[model samples]
Target chain A: MNRFIILLLIICSVLPVFAADFWLTQILSRSIILGVMALSLTFLTAYLGVVSFAQVTLAGIAGYTIAYFSANTAGIGAELPWVFAVLLALFFSTIAGALVGLIARQSVGIYSIMITLAISMAFFYFTRQNYSVFNGWTGFSGISAPSVMGLDLGAPVVFYYVCLFTGALATLFVVKFSSSPLGLSIQGVRDAARRVRAIGIPTSPVIVSAYAFSGLIAGMAGILNVWHQERVSSFSVGLGPTIDVLIISVIGGMRHPLGAFIGAITYVMIDTFAIDLISRDRFNTVIGLVLLLIVIAAPEGILGILKSVKERIKKIVLN
Target chain B: MKFFFIVFFNGLTLAALYFIAACGFTLIFGLMRTVNMAHGALLLLGAYVGYEVVEITGLWTVGIIAGGLTSAIVGAAIQAYILGRYQGDELRQTLITIAISIIMADLMLWAWGGLTYQISLPEMLLGGVRLPILNVGYSSVRLTLMAMAAVTGILLWLLIAKTKLGIIIRAGVDDREMLQALGFETKKIFVIVFAIGGMLTGMAGVITGSALSIAPGTDMQFLLSSLVVVIVGGMGSIGGAALGALLIGMAEQYGLAYAPTYGVVFTFVIMIAVLAIRPQGLLGRSEK
Candidate 1:
């Protein structure tokens, strides 16, 4: 599986050169960024049994921080070095994630969703209304990708490579973390919190750490998101994006890290191509229907279905 | 003092609307433990339906009833077809409702064309009433909304506190298994509760449509506010909903009056504070 993934990443990195399709590269990069965001959500949902609607919000925070620190049209944050700006954005997002984790510690299930939803909504409104800081609804622009080490990172190929590298690192981290002691304990808590607690595992910190780690991943995605778009707007971080990421996470399968990328690819494909078949106004209708069908038919997502098919094929071969 | 009174009255009216919308949410939560994310979409549907009714009949009251009934039917369908199968799985229920809301929102956008629509008030409630104490004019429609909220509140209170159905609902909330063991058709009760909840949300939607305006994305705004109210007042408690509404409404009014840009932030700040201090909410009983 690891070799297959590495081969796929290599193909993805070079495909842009052979095809030279700017739009395809853009979509692929977007899918990678969204996949990273969904990976964070999958990390929390798969391990902690917590479905947070705030991953986008955390990403938005990082995006805003990037917009602030870089020389942007909005001129909010000081013009800092790109590395410092990215690091600070990640720091803020991690802190925000930890705060949310602490706030939602006592609640489980729907209560946690509601709390995170409220926070996201609050951030959305705040950014929309506060003209001085968020530049109102228009948001900040003129945020080009930073050049580093004598390489023009703003070039599409380089940026795509950046996204691919970051996505790969995040997926690897999640895969390794899932097998770690803390990750196992968190999963144990998801299955039986009381039993885990009785067995001498301190569950709350584990949960909060999970949130922070997810935040870090989401923060990296956020920085990449802003660099990709060359702007940060309130719309990107609003309820729409929040739900979009949730749908992506669920559509890919919450059980495994690869599901996030699969789901992101599906979502980006639909988003990119749906306009060809239908009116722009009814685009969401198609997406909604697809999501509903997936929820109803394959609750475990596309990966789960593929896994089952693989299992059945193996049984047939044995027979 | 006059400014304060005006703010207070405006806050009270807003609180009344919040209470009406959130009570149903809390009730549904208390009984079914299902977080119907589609509640907002249902409210928006009610507003749109009510707008059409008023456009046709030119009677606000008729529109309100039609809207409520339409939303009730939709809500019942959702509860039966989608939520009913999920039972106690809150996560699946939440996702299902989110999907339903998305579909409903797209349908609404297609029908309404994303324009903000409002239902006209009746002739009697068209203008403001002179308040001698405050020496100012207050919108009669707002006063009527307060009266409607009071009536709904009283009726809901009676239904829950003074009826056998209420006892069953309370019993279900306290212990679903025990209620099931007692041979109560709890499924039927869930349907009834969902219908009533939908009706209340629809009615609130129409009222809100008349007073404010309803657009494609209004459902999310209303949903967020109702969630805040429920969180502050304590989920599944009528009195808690009322208190939460009052606090949120007053805070919003004052924020709008004093700091218009940050008006929405006040409710969330209150919510976060409540969550930090008492996760159970102001009037909610802590559960194990």
Candidate 2:
């Protein structure tokens, strides 16, 4: 297993360089960003039983903030340095995350899902119409990427590494959180809110914190997402992206943290290749059908299927 | 006063339209405790049927009936065959239904491209009638639609409150175990309820399609509306759905009327406010 882990890491590191000739770099980076978003969702859903439908919206808010801040204030020649702009974007995104958490954490079950969807839709439409700030539908272009101590930050390969590093950090944080006492408390709250309350556990704080954490992760993904697109539009964070995140989380197996990474890869690959194979018009049909099949077969997602199969094989071998 | 009347009447009309769409959604939700994400997809299906009818016969009434009936049949079949088997599993049911919705939406996209198609009402039903204070005029078709909705509501109310079948349904919602103890096939009841809900959503689609315009993303938009209605109305309450629909309808029209720019924001604000204030809904009965 240790060797396999090293081999897997080696493969991931070298594969991007090999596929750099094609659009695989973009694909991998997207998968990573999407993976980060999916990881946040999986953490919230699995531990808290909160299937927030606003992960993409949070991402969009982060992206739009970055774009807006990075907009050339000084007549295209100078601006409030890339670092400040990025910080401003991150701060705004955190606030957006907190706001979403506060509002969405009020209700439970499907009602909460609807509330998140509504809020996200409102944000999407608001940004789409408010041209003065978000530049309306045309969106803000020429938003430069972040550089570390004056390194050329505009390269796709550099951006990919940035995504990789953040994605890895996000994944590690989620795993650490999941095994902690806090994670257990969250699962406890989800499993039996009444019982937990009876035992003097404050349920609301856990849920709110989960939402905030999820938002922070989503915001980070959003920053990376804007950097990837280099042009943020309302279309970037609408129902389409929202649904894609849901599909990735569910398909990857919401049971485990690693499932997000797996689901992100499959969803991005399938969505991208499906679009490449056919036109954009028929993409949803194919994606939807795939979603249906995956749900029917593996309700726990791809990870669930893999685990179940592995267990079955072990049982057979022992017999 | 006349302008007020116009907004009020328009709001009611919109509410009536919303109620027609939400009835099926709330009914199924009542029994299943599952939000059928595909209800919107089903609405799109009915709209397509309407479109096909208009293309085939060029008669508005026939198209409406054909579209509604097709939606009902499809709804019934899917519920009876697929959802019926997944009784008592809310989470799995949600997953499956979402999948079904996606598949249906895709199928609709394949069958009818992304272009928007409008079905014209008959010449007789095209214009509005005048009243004293306000021109209270609208497509006669909408009037017919209101009448049909009223009839459906009355019948559904009777079925839920008056008939033996309705008693079984109520019992099923209150306690499936006791109902099953009495040897009633709750699964069959669920299937019937789901079918009826589908039929209602289909009818709504046909009416809405005729009233406005049916397009590819119509289902998603309707689904969002239905979710708002159900959440605002109370998940399992029929009356709640009607009241919720009316509120949303009024809010939407008035919001759009008052500030055309913030029209979309209005419904969302209401949803957030309602959920925050009364998580259950105005008329919703609390479940233990």
Chain A only: list TM-scores of all candidates.
0.95, 0.90
Identify the CAPRI category of the predicted complex in candidate 2.
medium
CA-RMSD of model 1: 1.6
lDDT of 1 by residue, A1-319 (tens): 7887889888887777675547545688889999999999999998899989899999998999999999998767688999999999999999989888887887888999999999888889899998877888999999988989889777878888888899999999998988999889888988999998998888889888888888998998999999989999999889999999999998999988889999999999889888888877777788788788888889889999998999999999999
lDDT tens digits, residue span A1-319, model 2: 3465457567776775667624545688888899888887888888888788888987887787777667533222225676776677667766776677777765667666777877887788777767667666667776668777867565777777787788878877877787788778888888888898898988877777777778778888988888877777878878878888988888899987778878989887887788778877777777777777777777888889898899999999999
Worst 10 residues of 1 chain B by lDDT: B81-90
Off by over 4 Å in 2: A1-7, A21-24, A72-79, A275-281, A313-319, B135-145
Candidate 1 structure lDDT: 0.90
B160-209, model 1: which lDDT tens digit per residue?
A: 99999999999999999999999998878898899999998998899989
Clashing pairs in 2: A131-A136, B24-B197, B128-B138
Q: Local error of candidate 2 at A86, Å?
A: 3.1
Model 1 has a DockQ score of: 0.79
